[model samples]
Structures are given as structure tokens and as C-alpha cells.
Target chain A: MEAFHRIWKKWRHLLIYGFILGLLIISLRLLRWKYVIADQSLEIYIGIVALFFMGLGVWVAMQWFSPQSKTAEETESIPGQEPFSIDEKALERLQLTEREQEVLGLIVKGYSNLEIAQALHLSVSTIKTHVSNLYSKLEVKRRGQAIGKARKLRIVE
Target chain B: MEAFHRIWKKWRHLLIYGFILGLLIISLRLLRWKYVIADQSLEIYIGIVALFFMGLGVWVAMQWFSPQSKTAEETESIPGQEPFSIDEKALERLQLTEREQEVLGLIVKGYSNLEIAQALHLSVSTIKTHVSNLYSKLEVKRRGQAIGKARKLRIVE
Candidate 1:
């Protein structure tokens, strides 16, 4: 029953069209038997009706499938405003301790050793030690190098 | 003349369809007059022709206007592989000199002043002066801050 429903959903339009065409043929044959269309102009009448239905099909297809709607969807985005999410894989691969990660985040935010110490409630020496450990783990020499590496690796936002 | 060309370009398909439709009607009418189709089955024949043309229209519209092709185009791009272009507007806003820009680019690449001097074939003291100028102009006291600002502002590729 489920498979039958799926097939019916896919081809319902064709089935509906075929049923309507059959009904029209029956009604028209009855009309022809009662009274023929005058001047043998039945072909012209059929040609006009066929062309109208063809145009209707084209219009319906355009409504359902036009690529312009996709282009409109794509043009709505403004670049660089996307929310920042840290790269967890890189952080894990670097094997930075929790304290070290905090220090690195502050360093990327342009905080000084004393500032970081105050913010984290640690001594200046402790902050300095964390900074050095970050540099070693990230394989960089200076603070600028550490910041560059962190941003490039997406280890910090 | 240009306006006429533009209109023609936009409606050429409709005009060609109209011409073909006219020819088909003429030939169909001629066939009806020349050879009478028997048994009053003309309506069924016309219904089949109409449905065939309508299906043709739908197929043509799907081929030319389907959004799936647009989606395929969008999925072809791999994120983060786009070529980086330096922001000239931010560079001009910062009023950085050519030499300062060069030094900043090197600094962002994790270069020490001494390494930058060697790369630029300049003395260490000159590189130090350029670095200091970059720090002051960029309004950042530390090298890390300068690197961060340069990247955030897209002043360096």
C-alpha cells in the first residue's frame, strides 16, 4: 500500500490528465454524432486548444522550476557577519591545556601579560608561563607569531 | 534600434513558437480537407497531439530553467579555497606606506624583525623602525595586536 501510494504521488498528474482527456473524447464524440461543427473547422479549433494547453504547461513549468528564485536566495547573504565557532578538531590536535587555551584566547584579543593575569586572577608570572607554553605547543617564537598561527589554524576566533 | 534588439532577444522564443504553431495549423487543416479521417475519431487524435506538445513544453522548460542546475553550480565551490585579495580601501584608510605594508605582510607571516630585515635585504634597525611605525599607525602597542588588526581589517592578504 505504501509503495502504491508513492507511485501514485509521482504520477498523479499524468493519470489525472489521461482521465480528463478520455472524458473530453467521449463528450466530443457524442456532440459529433448529434451535430457536426460547421465548415469542417474542427482542426483549427483543436489547434488553438492544443496551443493554449502547451503554453499553460510552459507557464506551470516556469513557476515550479525557474532558477531565478535560487539566485534570489543566494543574493540575500551579507559576508563576514557569520557567527564564529571554534574549530574543536584543531584545538584537540594541538593538545592545549584548559588554562593555555584561555591564555591563547586573551592573547588573540590583544591582552598583555599583566592584563591576562588580572582577568584570570592569576599572577603575572603564571600568565607568562602559560603564554610560553602556548608558543611552544603552537610552534611559534613570538606573541605575534602565536596570534597569527592561532587565527590561521582557527584555534581561536 | 538597440531597444528593438533587446525586445527581440527577450521574445525570440515566443515568436519562433508562434511561427511553428501557425505552420502546424495550416498543414493540419490542409490534411483534414484533403484526407477525411474516418469514424469521427478526430477529437481523440487532437487530444493526443495536444498532450504530446504540452509534454514537450514541460520537458523544454525543465531543461532550460530547472533550479537543480543552479544548485549543482553552487555546490561546486569548496569553502575557504577562494583566492584572497587585499583590501585596498582599508590600506588607504590606514595611510600605510609601501614599505610599512611590506613589513606588515612579513610580520603576519610570523616573521621576526630580524627575519623581515634579512628577507627585505635591510638592516635590523630599519626593520625595527618599520615595525614600530606599523604599531603606532595601526594604534596597537604590541606586535600581536598589530597582526590581529591587520588581518581583521584585511590589510594584508
Candidate 2:
């Protein structure tokens, strides 16, 4: 039972994907039989199969390219807390100052430093300093790289 | 020539998508012929028909989904630039202190306050302060809402 639980937890995503793919294949086969085996049913069957496969292909592609989950609902609920041990190490690598990290968040949104400073009510120089610090800690030289790193780390989005 | 350029630019993504979907349908038809079709010549004919319809389906879907030019690459290049523009007032709704923004990023990654402090090399109190500020700026009482607001503003992810 314990082993089953662990496998279920780890492979749920794969199981869901497999289930969807199985349904698609079965649907395709049904359409094939309905059309190829019957004369009057041919055109409608072909149309249905084409539509189903095309829709399935596009849906699969969308899932493939969907944004990584960063919703608060996904983040805040601790599933036994131990799941975060690996993430802790990634955070350690950032080495940001508290304020700098805050600025980095805004910077990732493609905010100009001036806009950030105004939003934060900090001196523009202070905002710039935090941004430079963020760049260093993220090991990225550009705002885009920092944002990419943050996303990869799941620190944002 | 100018008209051709205009049309090409407008329909480039649709054309690429159509080409890809066409290729997929062709491959699927080929697979079907190899496995299911008893007559080789008939199978080849069916494959060609499948490929044609697949191409047509993709063209139609492209016309459906390609009205917005917000490609994935473009979205990644500039983080907050969504295809649809929101109201200007909605844009101005939430503003975080630079430091609060950074903490929010780490928090979204399921970081504890102590972990966030250590990562940012700040005292726990300072981290808490930033967190509180983030909550206030986002007008949410919980960490999850802060993350949600950050996402909505495209501030973090």
C-alpha cells in the first residue's frame, strides 16, 4: 500500500497523460471502423476523425508549452514540507539582500528602475543598487536572464 | 510586392502551424497505411487525403488562434507584455517595494521566512517586514495572495 501510494504520487502526471492518449487512440480506431467499414458513413467519419485528432494535437501542444505553475495556491500549501529540500539549495545560490530580492521581482516584470523606485518609494540609486545586486546573485548579467533564472528556479511563475 | 509582404507577415505563424499539422497528419496516415490498410495503393491514396485535410484543418485553426501576435518568444522577451492589453488603471493597481517584491519571489518558491532571510542574508525580522509589506501592497493577508498578485502584475513570474 505504501509503495502504491508513492508510485501514485510520483506518476500521477504520467498516468493522466497516458489515459488521455489512450482515449485518443481508441477514438481514432472507432472512427476508422465506422467509416472504412461503411459506405454512407464515410464522409462524416472522416470529418469527425480529422477534427478530433486536430483538436487533440493542438491541446497537447498547448499543454506542452503552458507556463510553469507558480500560482499562490500551488505554492503555499505544503505537502509534507520535505518536498522543498532541493528548492532550499537553489534559494541559497541567489544570495540576495532582502530589499534587492524585492526589486528583482519588479525587474523581472520588465519594469524600468525608475518605475520600480517610484513604486517602492526608494531613491532611484537605491533601486539600481538592488537591481545590480540581484543580477550578481542570480549569476545573470541581463534583466532577461535574471527573469529566466527566477522562472527556472520556480521563484516566480 | 508590398501586399505580398503584408500578407506574409500577417499569416507567417498560421503557415508554420499549418505545415507542422500537415506533416503530423501525413505521418499518422502513413502509420495507419503500414499497419491497417490491406491494399498498398489504396492506403497511399488515403494517406494523401489525410495529409490534405490535416493541412486544411491547421490553416483553419491558425485563422482561429493567430489573431493575437503574442508569440511565446515575445512574451519571454518582455515579461509583462501580454497579447491583450488590460485597462491602464488595472496596470496601476498594485505596487510593491523593491525588497518586498524579491521576498515575494522566494516565498512563491515555498520558502520559509528563515530560509528567505538566509538566502537574502537578512535578519528574520527584516524578511518578515518585507513579507508584511508585500502582503499590504498586494492587498492580501496571505502569502498565496501575495504570490497571486505578483503573478497578476507580472511582477515575479
Give the whole-model CA lDDT for all candidates, comma-separated.
0.70, 0.57
Clashing pairs in 2: A99-B99, A101-B102, A102-B98, A102-B99, A102-B101, A102-B102, A103-B98
Q: Report how far residue A103 has shifted in candidate 2, in Å.
A: 13
TM-score of chain B of 2: 0.40
Candidate 1: C-alpha lDDT: 0.70
Model 2 C-alpha lDDT per residue in residues A1-157, reported as the tens digit of each score: 9889768745665677679867755655564555645675444444455676556545443333222221232233223333224354456555666787678677666577787889999899988778776765564445544565565555643
Supply candidate 2's per-residue lDDT for B1.
Answer: 98
DockQ, prediction 1: 0.25
Candidate 2: CAPRI quality band? incorrect
Clashing residue pairs in candidate 1 (N, C-alpha, C atoms within 3 angstroms): none
TM-score of 1: 0.47
Worst 10 residues of 1 chain B by lDDT: B67-76
Model 2 has a clash total of 7
lDDT of 2 by residue, B21-57 (tens): 6786566565554564556553344445544554555
Note the DockQ of each predicted structure.
Answer: 0.25, 0.06
